[model samples]
Target: MSDSKHRHKSVLKKTDEELLTDDLTHQLALHTRQGHNKFLSESIIPLMLCFACPFFVRSIVFICDHCHGSIHEFLQRLLFDHTLTLKDVLENFFFFKWHWPSAIIIIGFLIYAIIMTMLLPGDEYQGPITDTGHIPIYRNNGFCYYIVSLIIFTILTVVLKLNNLSPTYIYDQWDAFLSTVSTFAFLLCFCVMIKGKYMPSTNDHRSSSNWLTDFYRGVELYPRIFNIDVKLITNCRYGMLSWALLSVIFCMKTFELYGYTDSALITCILTLVYLTKFFWWESGYMKTIDIIVDRAGFYLCWGCLVWVSGIYTLPCYFLVTHPKQLGFQLTILILTLGLLSIYINYDCDRQKIQVRSTHGKCLIWGKPAKIIRAKYRLLNGKESESILLASGYWVLSRHFHYIPELALAFLWTCPCGFQYILPYFYVIILFILLMHRAHRDDQRCRLKYGDAWIKYCDLTPWKVWPKIY
Candidate 1:
């Protein structure tokens, strides 16, 4: 064989660690990595919300006396009115109070969740390779942890009433609990940033040179502490698990205060079903943008810790006090639509998983699946192939799954009725988030797959909504 051909063969056979240390291959990897921008979004906005969200929930949703007015009028009085002052804002919106009991419970529960994750038996799944040649090994025990935790919590709160702990504890302490979770988010972000800088788990990390950027965007792709995956604990266990628990907690609160309101019950049940769907398909999520591309920084870590805990449950929280009848017909209509959206969303994910797992050999919608075998080169100069799904819901839009996701959010929020827009905040935020994610995913794929991605886009036309987006 020729000397050049022999050298290429040797390079291809090198281990991932050796390939990463090779200077030429490392340089090739850098060329494929995408750049991060939008400094205002990455830094300032999230910081402001980190402090502001709790205040909004407490003052506006929990204690606001201006519900009699229209949302426009409420905003006008709060923001545009000349009568507004710093004193009023401080007194109403920025009051800080600490409740040690609630704070301790919140902290203890997080630690307990970590313990559960460590002890739980889970299937092992390997994530995609990173630019630095590290592939994350995740323990897919989320569904197990979720079910076990719920059972334990139900026994403690409802069945046994251990230590006088009731399901309504979170509801009764909502004000202080919100503050505690938010504070934890801030602290968690700071600790994660420090750890990423000094004690990253692997070579798949870098400093942005700017501390603020490093803090906002995260320093590491995959971070671990004491052999525990930080994102798995924060994102899956702490964030998503809290979202599910709070839904039931809010439902319990509604039952305690008012009778069993159909609206609140429907919202809570549907939200649980959707979250159950999440845990079921979580392995797919580990490969998506949130886990794959985003680093262990404030945007992700703090979001899972705080935003998922607080904002994701806003509709249920709003319904705790503001129960609605919705009657029989309306309830049936909303329930049917909500359940259908959940199934479609689940099916969309299933289709892609099916095609990828079977190498496009499976039938989609009773026909042979269509796929694009997008070819690319890894940092080692070795060619690789990725399947770009084009069958089932994927044929409708590049991110057709997101459409059903947004619909599910709206359906759950619908129980709150149109009397106030506060409960619909989740729907609005989800739309914006999913839209941005769809765009970001496209850009990431384009950078990774180049011409093959372009061909896939040519075949799929729609970005998210068919013939509209």
Candidate 2:
């Protein structure tokens, strides 16, 4: 094994960037040898860490809320207060009762979404080519769907005067809503795994021998059911729409309880603007890591179905219980920060989309844009060129958009104060999630573009933070 030892020594002598490139290449080689798609990993252990969140993190959050949003009081009461029995504690903190109303509502929403997809008129957009030479198609009806859904919701609550369909109903029944969503998400994950394994709807699939990985990591990149795009429905329509609606509901709840508060108003406005921007840029998002790289299983499906609803709305949810007035000065400061962050995030995406759409003939900051002609090969040995924008915010960091995203989350949640860490949960989780995504995206692009990706990385070394990361 002298040759092997010599090779290892040679690798050890390489520069950091070279070493990273070699490691990425080695990982791809291993995946190829293992008969797995080199583009999508067989094991998603890093992502699967989120699996524990539903069981553990959510349970703790529920318990904290149950104890009136006081973690210390909850612990003290649990340890010292012998009035609570084991059964009572378990039933209250851990066990979730299946509320028929919430369950039916969630199911109805899904069915309604499916029906809307079938009936709605939307522009057809083609996605990036997959490893299996399939180009997935998506409907650009997200913004229209969002507007229609909001109007209908408003009609149901204000015009129809249905108490059950009130805006604050979901927040009122938070635990039951969460329970129904988690159960549905779990069952949906199983169905997608089965479909990907035996009844794949598209040629863009990569099934592994391991069923668990297939279940968690997903076997298909773009899996459709009943002529509707599954990712488009679950991610954009259901999950994201739910997040927006929940923000409105939480704000309504806060007003209903504590009257008008600038904190809630600011939070609600910023959240809507952010989600509106998302719908406005929905087509561009289809090429992102969530849709393009991650598949349609537990990590994505369950995440959209459950995590987005539960975790992403943590700030708004927290404000419902702990409503406080930040007055004018602090509120204005937070609002300004949140708005600026949203604009930066939007501009970052716009810049990249403009550069690519114009084929790098665009201007950045009123000057000619700088870009790299990065080339990559398709699975069928066909070569293609991609313009990598190295100007504007992109020059600051590879994933500079994520910085503003994090800042926006923090700015909105900052009004919750530091009395308890519950409100900061969204910011904390988003930080970890974005950091992982940035790294995962770097590795994926490195493997896809090889030397060209290496050149881009050399030109932009930072992942998400400039001069720091």
Model 2 spans with C-alpha error above 4 angstroms = 1-51, 79-97, 160-165
Q: Can you give the lDDT of residue 212 in candidate 1? A: 77
What is candidate 2's lDDT per residue for 283-354, written digit by digit as tens? 999988788777798889888988888888878888877888998899888988899999999999999999
* Tens-digit lDDT string for candidate 1 (262-315): 999999989899989999888898888888778888789878877787788888
Structure candidate 2, residue pairs in collision: none
Alpha-carbon local distance difference test for all models:
0.79, 0.79
Q: Each prediction's TM-score against the native? A: 0.87, 0.88
> How does model 2 score by TM-score?
0.88
Q: Residue 236's C-alpha lDDT in candidate 2?
A: 88
Say which candidate scores most in TM-score: 2
